[model samples]
Target: MRKPVLTIFYQYNPWQSTIGGIQSLINTFIKFAPDTFSIRLVGTGADNGQVVGQWHESELLGRPIQFFPLFTLLDDNVRKLVPTTVRYTAALLSKTLQSDFMHFHRIEPTLAARGWLGDKTLFVHNDIPQQMSSAKGAKTILWQQFPQLYFWLERQLMEQFDQVLSCNSASTKFYQQNYPSMVNRIMDVRNAVDTSCFKPLAPGPYQQAKQQLLDRLRLKPSTRLLLFAGRLHPQKDPLLLLRALAATPPESDIHLLVAGDGDLKSEVEQAIEQHNISSRVTLLGAVPKEEMVTLYQVSDVFVLSSRYEGLPIAMLESLACGTPVVTTDCGQGPSLLTSESGLVVSQREPQSLAQALVTVVDNPQRFTPEACMQAVSPHSAQHVVEPIYNSMLQRWHVSQANS
Candidate 1:
């Protein structure tokens, strides 16, 4: 049988920013997508104004991948407005019309190309309008001032997609309540982890791994390791984690390992200095994805103090590594966590987060590594991807028969 063509549309290049959850999902999809499908990735390359309207061939998952650089044709003004959805849609329409199935990782492109999206699937990673409202500075003011217009436009664009795949229950519920007519189109396809790579180490290997990390960082074995991985941005609220760390007892031998960098790096550093917890924290800025599993294995607990999220991959990765998480109730954290794997604080305040961290660290046995690993089995890459791929193929077949 001839393979169906699957065209994926995303705004940014995963190769360029390999740090985010969205990028990880796109990479995972490309890595594990069935061989029966011919894959093409449509995204923006570096805006060097050199590679626009070009098709570049590469290998992903041992299969051929054709990449279309749509942003090369976009001018600076248009690129600035790319976040608005309409501009990139126009760019993608000409290139994406030939695929058997179209999958979009971002909403703006999906909204722009709605007319040609009869077989398209829109993957909702976050609440769009809410994110806009929560955005910093002038953008937030604009979104707040014209809430109805923004939501109306968003609803119209979302309704056009044949299938809407949400990564969390919170997003599914938001769309169902806001757009009742389109409830049937929404499907919950949660985020997943690679269990094979992130599985817990045996006692001997685990102890050695912990010791190696401690030796490298020059910390004693008795010192507890707390990890915070991801962007050091306002949305991630890295400062809150710093405050919480400062609030922990000064005598406690707790140390924090920060593994990512962003625009908020200077601010985070300033706050670290302000809090006088510099000695207790080390910034191992922007570690590679392969190293993340090792960090998780060595750590006592992973912490995320985000203001909002859809479903963070770091939380899932930590659980898969059999390391418990202590996070604020954000995104799908509340839905994915249980007493066995992690603790979820109700408030985003430093005091609440600190208390939860101290409690989890003090009684590490309460959340067993084996239980943490087991809880994430359902969210393995194989389990999540197979069903979604099958469903997409089935939908494509139905659409073809009707046409």
Candidate 2:
């Protein structure tokens, strides 16, 4: 018997080396999606005026991954009025036809490409209402360009996708409630991690990386390291973690590493200065993929101070690394962790997060490595993403029959 084949066209952030949930999700999909599925990702490249109108085929973790960049020639200044995503949508819309399934990772992208999508499409919504309702969303292209139709666009785009995968249960309900007509398509799925890459590391490389970081920080081995890995955006609220660090007792043997880069870089740097805890927090922007795993392994506790989320992949990756987490209310943290593994504080409260951090660092045995690994096992790619891949294929098959 022969295997059935399908092609998936994925769109998210531009093709760049960034540490993020959607980027990690793309990696997981590339590594774990069935051999029968051909993955073609579309994003603008930092191609330096070189690779426009070209298809670049590459491999990730030995699995084939293809990429296409639509608008690579425009200068950064020119891109302000005509964004890469806008260019991407314009070109795809004008194309003759496209792949079997078009999977998008954001609301605006789905809206931009709605006219070009088919019934087998998927939208991996992060947080529809929460993100869309924010002041940030108010400034997005959808609002700036078509202010009156943004909400209508959200409702209408829901009808275009065959499936909508939410990163957590709350987001699933958000979609179901806001777009009741498309409720049947919404699915609540936990974000997946590459267990193969994100497990507790043994003494050699892990120790080297940990020791290097410690030496560079000029800190003793006894220092408790709190790690925050994600974009420094309003949604992530990295400054909240810095504020919590400020609230901690002055003599506490704790240090924080914020491993990400974004629009809020200056704000975070300013907060560090204003708080006058420069020694307590180190803002190491955008650590590499392999080095991130090392940070996860060596860190005492992982942290997130996001205003809202749909189960952040960084959180899951941290858990998979056998690192306990202390985070503000978000994602599957409530259900995926126990008192023995992590703590989920009330949303947006720096004080509660401050105490939770101290508690997790103090009771290391309480948040055991064994427990963290077990808690995140179900979210491994084998257990979650493969099923999603198979279900998508099955749904697309049915769609073909109905047509």
Q: Pick the candidate with the highest lDDT.
A: 1
Model 2 ranges off by over 4 Å: 1-15, 48-50, 73-87, 111-119, 134-148, 203-208, 395-403
All candidates' TM-scores?
0.88, 0.87
C-alpha root-mean-square deviation, candidate 1: 3.7
Best by TM-score: 1
**Tens-place lDDT digits, model 1, residues 189-264:** 8787877677788899989988998999898889899999987766678889999999999777899999887667
Q: Write the per-residue lDDT of candidate 2 for residues 1-403, one digit (tens) a residue.
A: 2343344443332334565687688777777878777777766556455375577776666777676665554232121455545566676665533567666765555645566645445546355455555453333234444545767766766677777887767778877887787788887777889999999977687778788889988998878899999877777888789999999987778999989887678889999999999988888887778879889999999998876677788888999998999877755566778887899897566788999999999998899888999989988989988787788677667867886
Instruction: Provide the lDDT at 186 for model 1.
Output: 84
State each model's CA lDDT, in order: 0.78, 0.74
Model 2 TM-score, all chains together: 0.87
For model 2, state the Cα shift of residue 174 in Å: 2.7
